[model samples]
Target chain A: MDIPTFDDVLAAQDRIGPHVHRTPVLTNGQLGDLAGASLFFKCENFQKVGAFKARGACNAVFSLTDEEAKRGVATHSSGNHGQAIAYAAGRRGIHSTIVMPKTAAKPKFDGVRGYGGEVVTCPPGTRSREEAVAAVLERTGANFIHPFDDAHVIAGQGTCGLELLQDAGHLDAIVAPVGGGGLISGTCLAASGFSPATKVYAAEPEQADDACRSKRAGHIVEDDAPQTIADGLKASLKPLTFHFVANHVSEVLTVSEKEIVDAMRLVWERMKIVIEPSSAVAVAAVLKNRELFAGQRVGIILTGGNVDLDRLPWAG
Target chain B: MDIPTFDDVLAAQDRIGPHVHRTPVLTNGQLGDLAGASLFFKCENFQKVGAFKARGACNAVFSLTDEEAKRGVATHSSGNHGQAIAYAAGRRGIHSTIVMPKTAAKPKFDGVRGYGGEVVTCPPGTRSREEAVAAVLERTGANFIHPFDDAHVIAGQGTCGLELLQDAGHLDAIVAPVGGGGLISGTCLAASGFSPATKVYAAEPEQADDACRSKRAGHIVEDDAPQTIADGLKASLKPLTFHFVANHVSEVLTVSEKEIVDAMRLVWERMKIVIEPSSAVAVAAVLKNRELFAGQRVGIILTGGNVDLDRLPWAG
Candidate 1:
């Protein structure tokens, strides 16, 4: 697998620029007071498909050759990536197929179908999901776009950090939640090219700390069905994401499930924005380790806002 | 009571400009598609104290004479107005007293106390609340700032519409939820000054349709503790607000309780922002009266984002 470079990110920025929102960087003085840091929130919650996944999916879908594009794209995701692929493919006027577990939320399926994607449901399990995607590719001759492992996807996600640097200059550090590591990996490469002195950090859930373990062991680490409230961060780091983490990331901070929920509630109550638990992980890390960021300028990426409103983590 | 004019609005704009946020006007294509009209949402939900009440309260607090300022400010309320008064008074480093019913939520008291305001508890009747405020005023010599009936507050709330017109130019119509009619009344004056061609419409809950009845009857219509999910819209319109509604407002649109909840959920789900039920009343009005606003550009003021997260109307 090829590792994505800053130049690839620049190219991806141009490719996906028109498709994604240059989301605002919001700051709250009250929240700042609590964290004891000047925090700039890169609000990808307001991005296309309500997540940063749109950038990667758009770049991947549009990067295909005309011959390859004619066959369309396929992906297996039960979350934002599925909707992103469908949305991006719709933008290019091409068909996209999303493979998901049959147990995926009704809204997730609706989200994919809303963007004109064909949904293929598989039985629960990673093997079943992969087999379903393989079957779709075999039957439709569509190109497979891995959610995070692909170079194009990482490069595409890098555009978020590039835009963040452009919008909020001279950040002492940048923190992004590490799930499959696509966003944080891209952020690390962006920081390297755009602002070399800006430290890049990843916030991971302590309940599912494979990425943190992988960093310490200097290799890929897998979690066997690790459970956490941050459903998006369940996936462990893959080889491509692990490469960027090993080379560029400064630290992998782990936060408790309670901390994540508390951070999520604070953002909602104070900043008046809906953010998923994955996004709160980064905030939780910053707040939990106030000494590390005290009086410093930090940028925290709010990766997405696609939450089930009826089932918020803080609510009964 | 003196009727506030466009000049007062302009003056209030300058007075409160330094204190309140010139909040962003957000648009979601999906929401526009649903409404069958291009919608520009003036997001006062992001304003200080999480409501446009900050605008009115700040203006009232700052408009006082030096002698009046020394006496400080006082208001009787159990919601956003209480917090707004506290916040505005704190900005000037002056004392503020917020009188509330003993049954008011604990968070409401905390919000006032958070801003260093004294919270005076009164029994649950209007007479008791008024008497409590009277006692506070007699003891502290604090200037009374009526939530909506005051000219400075009306002028202050008008600034929201002025900013809306400046941001979203040439709106065919503007909709605001009518509580005591401060927001919509001010919006009417703003439309008259900034964009005379733009009609102003008020959205009222069906349960608390006093404002709607008042508009039709050409006089004030009071509801005796009318109940709705939109807790912010329970107050009846006063003489000053009635003056603006009778002379300037084009129509008063009422929506069902279920419609407001649906609109609130839709905004949270699609626009990825937190909005209280009062804000949703305006969106619900535009959605329910589709033919009235179809193919037109409409501006809707999202009045606030203060809600009990644990007890969402849609949740069981």
Candidate 2:
């Protein structure tokens, strides 16, 4: 298994610069005052494919050989990563096949289709999705673009932190959502490489806090079946991701679903920016642990915004 | 009263450069396909007051004499301009007395108060709001800042256009929401000043299109008791605003409340940005007038995002 370094992320930035948006950094004076922290939100919700997943997806897709690219790419994702792979492949005029759980939101399925990718439905649960994706790989000989756990993917995702540091200049600490830990590992690598003075942290939802548990126990841990409004942050950490997170990250914070919802509402209401629960987890951590970050310039990565409008957590 | 021209708008860029955000020009392929035009949205929904009104209000507040600013500023508005004036004045440690219609959205009133502004609520009518504002002005000797029809306000509003043109370069036409013609007039002056070739237009809801009526009639026109989801655009044209509109604007287009709501929904659904109905009016115009703008870069100013979240049109 390969491990990505700062040089790989630097190369990925050059590769992906023309494709992705350098999303705006939005500041909220009210939220800053209330939380007792000066925050910088690298709004990856505005990134291509409406998430940070685009960075990983694009890197994996574009790194392939001409013959490999011709065969097409395959991935299994419940939501954001599926759409991301679809969007990245489509932009390069390459074919993409996504194996999605049937229980996934209709909007995610639509997003994959909108990006000109083929969708294969599987029954709900990890085993079924894995089986379906495996069957597709055997049948079509398509390259498996793992959502995380891949060195190329992590290096690709690292560009987001590279951008935050590039834009904000100096930061005391960095916080990001911990799903499968691709974003967090990438963030750790980027932060450690560029500025050793900055400490990296992971934010996770309590219901689906496998990453926090894994870090605390100093081993990979899986939830007893994941659950959270932050569907993008529901996945457990993998070996490579766990290695980076355990070594580089300083701490992990947990936020309740109510706190996540309140954070989402505040971003939508006060900042007029749309952010999903996964993104809100980072904000929730900032608001909840204000004492830890008071007067410090904290950089937060907004993970995604591919949410179902009708199923908004705050809505009745 | 002194009049503003393209020259004044150019100068406003130098004046308010440090104060306001040069908000991003946002576009997505999905949103572009729906409107049948190449749309570059100047996201003033991300502005200081959550709208372009912050530009004008800040300009007006800053233009006041030292003695006048010490006495504070007073205005009568039930929407974005009221909040803009309040927020802008608060930055300068200047007091603000905002007279708003009692029927205004609770969020708007709360926003004004949240900015350290004094709020005086009157009955839901022009006469009552005017009387209340006059009382405040007389009592405090505060500087009277008209929401529109003021040279400084219009010049401030023009700054939004200046930032747009700087980022987007040359554009075919610019469409902005019209509420007492403040943003539109400022946009017109800015557009003409920078690129004399770009046409400037105004968008309004059909129910309260006093500017559209005034454009055609060559005089100020009242709404005769207005009704529209675009609460920010309910104001009738004033003499100074009418004069600027008559001389500079290319045309005024009107859309139904349903169209405004539909456009607002698309922006939220596709762009993942929360925009108020007034901002949607400009988008609605581009969607309504596709033939004229197709294959051309149309600049649309998303004027505000101060909509009542509890009473969102989509929720209703």
Candidate 3:
């Protein structure tokens, strides 16, 4: 697997600079007091398509050659990735196809469609999703963009970390939620070059602790549909993402589902910004392991803000 | 009656500059398209106390003379005003007595206390509330800071509009929700001096339409405890606030409870920001009167972001 370098991150930053928002870095005094850490939150929740996926998707779509661009892009995702791919493709004035599970939420389907992506649904399984994407690529001759496994996508995601280091000045540590490890691995690579002293950490749900287990086992570990409220973090790490996480990440912290929910509510109540469960995972890790971060300046990436308003986790 | 002039607003801006946030102005393309107008939202929801009440409260508290401040300040309120007084007083290192109704939510009581205010609970009624404040003033010789009637408070609230005009550049009209008319009155004064051509309008709940009727009758109209989901807007206008509304406000638009809730949800879903129902009143007005605002650049003040997570209006 080809690993993304710091130069690649800088190049991606230059290419996708005009497309994505350089989202604000926010801090809450009350939340800081609770965690016993001076916390700086890089708000990717305010990103276009409402997630950091925009950075990676835009980089991938924009990096395509003229011949590749004619066929457009295809991605298998039912969440923010699908929306980001569609939005990025739309910005490029290209046709895109999104393969989603039939069991995905209606808003997710709507979000992809709203961004101008043609959606194809399959049965709820890895095999089905892969088959659907293969069929779309075969029929349409579209270039398939893996959600988190592509080198261009990883480089694009690293820009988020590069920005955090630039905006936040100095951080003792940086924590990002690990899903398929795109964001976290990118963060690891960004920190490696931008701020060598800054330790990179990954936060994950205990229910879906494949990344955490893999770190200890010294290999890629996959879970068979392990469930968690952090719906964005259910995916296991791919070979490309695993390589970066294994080498550059300092630690992988896991938090209980209850801890994740509590952290999510704390941010909503204190910061007054809507963040999804995946973003809350990094906060949960900080709050749960206060000893490790106490009295230190730390940065956490707020990954996304897309959630069903009708079904808030805390609401009765 | 001492009506606050635009000069007082400018003075308040300088005095409260260090205490209050120079809140950001945001826009949404999708919402603008839906409204048929370009919308600029002054995000006072992200204010120091999570409400624009901080602007007025800070101005009032900081304007107090050293001798006068020694006796501390007192106010009769159970909502944002109560919390604002507490927060402002805390910032000034002075004692603040907030007289709240016993029927008020526990969180409101906690909010005031948490901000270092002395909470004095009275039996729920205007008579009891007045008596409670009177007793506190008589016992402690604290200066009574009338929530909306005071000149300093009105001038302080005016800073919000001044900031909106300064940040948003050119607005055809500015809309704010009318509660006791403090915010709307402030907007009127700000526009009169800074953006004279910009019309100032008020949005009010149909249930609490006393402001609308009062504007028509050319006199103050009191509601006998009007009920609405917008708890912050239940209070009727006082003479000081009524003067500004009658002389400067262009119109008072009223919206139904459903419209308010729908607008509130639309903002939450699209903007990914938490806003109170009172703030939603302004957005509802812009949506309800699309013809008046179509193709025009309109400014809407999002008043606050203080809401109970468990008791969302749309939640079961």
**Model 2's CAPRI class?**
medium
Who wins the DockQ comparison?
1
Displacement of residue B18 (Cα, Å) in model 2 is 3.3
> Chain B TM-score for each model?
0.99, 0.96, 0.99
lDDT of the candidates, in the order given: 0.94, 0.87, 0.94
Report lDDT (Cα) of residue A246, candidate 3.
90
Per-residue lDDT tens digits for candidate 2, residues B13-71, read: 77777778889898777778876777899998888878888888888887777877899
Tell me the TM-score of each prediction against the true structure: 0.99, 0.96, 0.99
The list of candidate 1 runs beyond 4 A from truth reads none
Error of 1 at A227 (Å): 0.7
Q: Assess each model's interface with DockQ, reporting 2 decimals per model.
A: 0.87, 0.66, 0.79
Q: Which rank order by lDDT, best down to worst?
A: 1, 3, 2
* Native-interface RMSD of candidate 2: 1.3
Worst 10 residues of 2 chain A by lDDT: A307-316
lDDT, residue B78, candidate 1: 91
State how far residue A251 of model 3 sits from its true place (Å). 0.5
Real interface contacts reproduced by model 1, as a fraction: 0.91
Candidate 3 chain B lowest-lDDT run of ten: B240-249
- The better-scoring model by TM-score among 1 and 2 is 1
